[model samples]
Target chain A: MSFSPLIQQLITSLRCLPGVGPKSAQRMAFHLLERDPDGALALAEALQKSVSEIGHCKLCRTLSETEICDICSATDRDSSVLCILESPIDVLAVEQTGGFNGLYFVLSGHLSPIDGIGPEDLGIDKLLERVQSSDIKELILATNPTVEGEATAHYIAAQVKDLGVKVSRIAHGVPVGGELEFVDGGTLAHALAGRRSLL
Target chain B: MSFSPLIQQLITSLRCLPGVGPKSAQRMAFHLLERDPDGALALAEALQKSVSEIGHCKLCRTLSETEICDICSATDRDSSVLCILESPIDVLAVEQTGGFNGLYFVLSGHLSPIDGIGPEDLGIDKLLERVQSSDIKELILATNPTVEGEATAHYIAAQVKDLGVKVSRIAHGVPVGGELEFVDGGTLAHALAGRRSLL
Candidate 1:
């Protein structure tokens, strides 16, 4: 409990990460001190570099080193088909699948009305502008299947439907290769309601 | 795989912690990036501060801010009963029990011949000097229950026995809360050999 000022400082700082409490922070601080001094220095440098260098892409709001992210700049990607996602990590998920050739519009966050977050806060206006300006054929809503995620997707779908751009929401159900027994009630219900013909 | 340079750098640095591999490191880096910029900055500052300010205690070789650690400076602690441990974390473990009021002697490591770590490498010479100079009545070998821990304890016990000091090694067995069926054979053997007469 009576760690040095510096050790205390490090522990206090480490607690800022989600789920890292005081005890974990202390453990992590001691871990860095005992094992890897160079790693600590590297982490420090990386933190500074990340904060100073990485910014939002001008077009999609995805994290990027330059004004435009690699996804936005790639000419090979389908500019006509745009997928709207909630975060940069989601973009990575989609990228990993290698299924869609479309570009993305990262909202950076979803609408949480109780937390004072709304459509304007999530760059929906920019999304509309991009939809109208470009020869975009389809707008795919790929937000998560949470309550707020569904609400955000529906809100966006309503706003963009009249603009003549065909809007579609990503299917929600049990994950690929997942057992039906393990699937939750909400997901099962959604999967049933949104069911399509197998043929 | 295609993280931004800053994000990738952060993830790489975070992997240096014990039990942290590439995936966990990536999660930590992303968590910090998405949630707490201020916390990340704080952790970075603390890393630099802890590395630069904190050093080993002159007497015990344990991590400390001053020349003599708080435990060494305390008048209530029994200097005559020294507990020799393998690392600073061991000292914390002993202190947490609040059962021992004695000072500590940290080896910073154990004797591992296979790893090219021996008596001299683990500060056995320094420990002998401390025992010889002081009015030490008892020298408690409280190292871990590993083979290396036992070897180091035996090596130190041989040296301290010649100095007319009472050398004793802590008992090993199934932990207090551990299930008897799950306890390992080596530990059970050690426990049986060191059995005390129940009154």
Candidate 2:
């Protein structure tokens, strides 16, 4: 059945999110009306507020309500040990693990020559500048293990080789709890190549 | 690694949509930032506009931006034939068949005593008033075939029985193109129970 223009528009808007098709969007629209009208209102409010109020952190390029991000402002985080990531979402993934206490540098995007995204497009120049000017001892490249991600990391590592900072790439392999039989060949190869010696 | 408060809140707020779990919400948030920033902004705009502008149609209670819905205002539609449905979404479902040419009355809910929802809660009084005052010749009860939906339809049918108008409930059974093996036993039973002889 065809929806009214208002509902159709709302469903179309919701389909912009990942994995949301026309059916799922319609279901979500109805669910909002049925379960949590307040949540729908809050979502509308947050969309407006976040779209207008949030901006890139001046230092780390991550999303922030203020000039600098929370990590940049936190004195408890190790500024000397910085974890460089591809985007703001990556920062969240790393943060959710609760294993790293270092500060972060978000590139906002990765380099893709085929897509016309180069060093300047990805903010690699700013990263080099931060490395050159800061008192950072180690620069950990935590970009994805994709071909483009690897190329971008290599390019950054090349540029900072002479900057007196220890540049290292994070190990790429199967996940900790993943089974060998279930792991893809490429990931298994990556894990084998990056294998460490027993203590 | 820890997420900034802004990023965390964005992910959490996104999970309000149906079928969106934490992983999907994270993926959606990333996709918005990475691939379709414009689409995300459009969604934000649509959400705000729909919530602020759309309301119930003054006559039928279906969602609409104006006082009367398009179906209600259309000259080609039969105003004397009204399809009583469970919600605005049900109106869309019927319209998709392209067979019905009548106005719609959205109940906004089904009668569910377990949930404390009754005929009064679903605007049965308003429906009675409309049927009594209007030139309606037929009231088509198109609520879902579930137990509560059936009960609600029966209650409405009984209420309007003395008013001298023809009252009919939509047939409940297997879908038009459904396969026998694929269909559940409950649906087959319903189809058999509501069967009609071919003339």
Candidate 3:
């Protein structure tokens, strides 16, 4: 009944993924060894390569292979406007829409004191340095709508207010395809208060 | 918005896992590269090593690092009793129960004509060879209760009937925690048909 120690090790290693459990890890290990070893090899090499090569951008703190990220280094992007987000994934989310052509400053994570994460842990001082030193006119807070995200945003806003940078937040409202009846009270209230007038 | 090609490749390769999608892959890639590079490297090495080293057993067709699986090569297990199952995972399931001390033959998959799988696809001939060459007293069909599994079990039974081998199918019944009302009619029927006196 017991699998070989190596097979057991492979299964345990796969459990490092976000949502994977023991059963899923076992399935993944079996799949990698059985069905597509080449694909599995690619994933293996990719994991090592990405981990070795990828690092946080000096300016934005987003994932990059070099010292600076593409978005941070791009000449066309508006450096005068910066978008703040909880993670690099949010940067990708905003970038995919082509709606924001501004530079970004990734917090890397929200301020969660329970997890020993705070403003300092999120590198908020580095963000303040960018605002104080640059001609940045707008700092858009695009962190998640969770309590920690809101607290982090408020903290950042207060820190940058003296620098004369106009701080804004991405709107919180009912999702476009969501029904109002299913929407939570907090979201509905934000939607009502942040309502826009039609031209 | 597009990640580096290495990151992209990692994400794409992660999708090869069962139930993994674009979003989870991205999350996994980020978690590996960002949070735990050492653990990521271990996983990478494990994946490569397992894929390269692991192979099917010559006799039982279960995962092993050699020409034959440990279970098939073991002398302590009963050689006269053979259990046929649809996958190596099923072998683990049976072995874990501490019930079966017999030898095993893993089909790897069941008969699925729609997917171009047949008796040959499952290497039924190899199983037949084992049956013909060994002093097998009993053959237990432990395939799933699905239509394809049933068909596969029937096909196996027909192929071995003339060999004087006593073939038996694993019982079908309601799951342990399943409510009687919620149990499928087929399972309920099987339960009724297989009922024995509890004396």
**Considering summed lDDT, which 10 consecutive residues are worst modelled in model 2 chain B?**
B1-10
Model 2 CA deviation exceeding 4 Å by range: A1-5, A30-38, B1-12, B26-42, B196-199
lDDT of 1 by residue, B104-133 (tens): 999968898888988888888988988888
Q: Tell me the alpha-carbon RMSD of every candidate.
A: 1.9, 2.7, 2.3
Superposed Cα RMSD, model 2: 2.7
Candidate 2 reaches a DockQ of: 0.51
How many pairs in model 3 have backbone atoms within 3 A of each other, for residues 3 or more apart or on separate chains, i.e. clashes?
A: 0
TM-score of chain B of each: 0.94, 0.93, 0.96
lDDT value, residue A65 of candidate 2: 76
Give the candidates in order of DockQ, highest first.
Answer: 3, 1, 2
DockQ scores for all predicted structures:
0.64, 0.51, 0.73
lDDT, candidates in the order shown: 0.85, 0.84, 0.89
- Score every model by TM-score: 0.94, 0.89, 0.92
Q: lDDT value for candidate 1?
A: 0.85
Candidate closest to the true structure, highest DockQ: 3
Runs of candidate 1 with Cα error greater than 4 angstroms are none
lDDT of 2 by residue, A42-94 (tens): 77666656666677888888877789887899889889988989988888788
lDDT per residue (tens digit) for residues B1-199 in model 3: 6997777888998888888988999998888877878889999899989988888998989888888888988889999999999888888899999999999999979998898887898989999999999899999999988998899999999999999999999999888888999998989999999998999
Interface RMSD of 2: 2.4
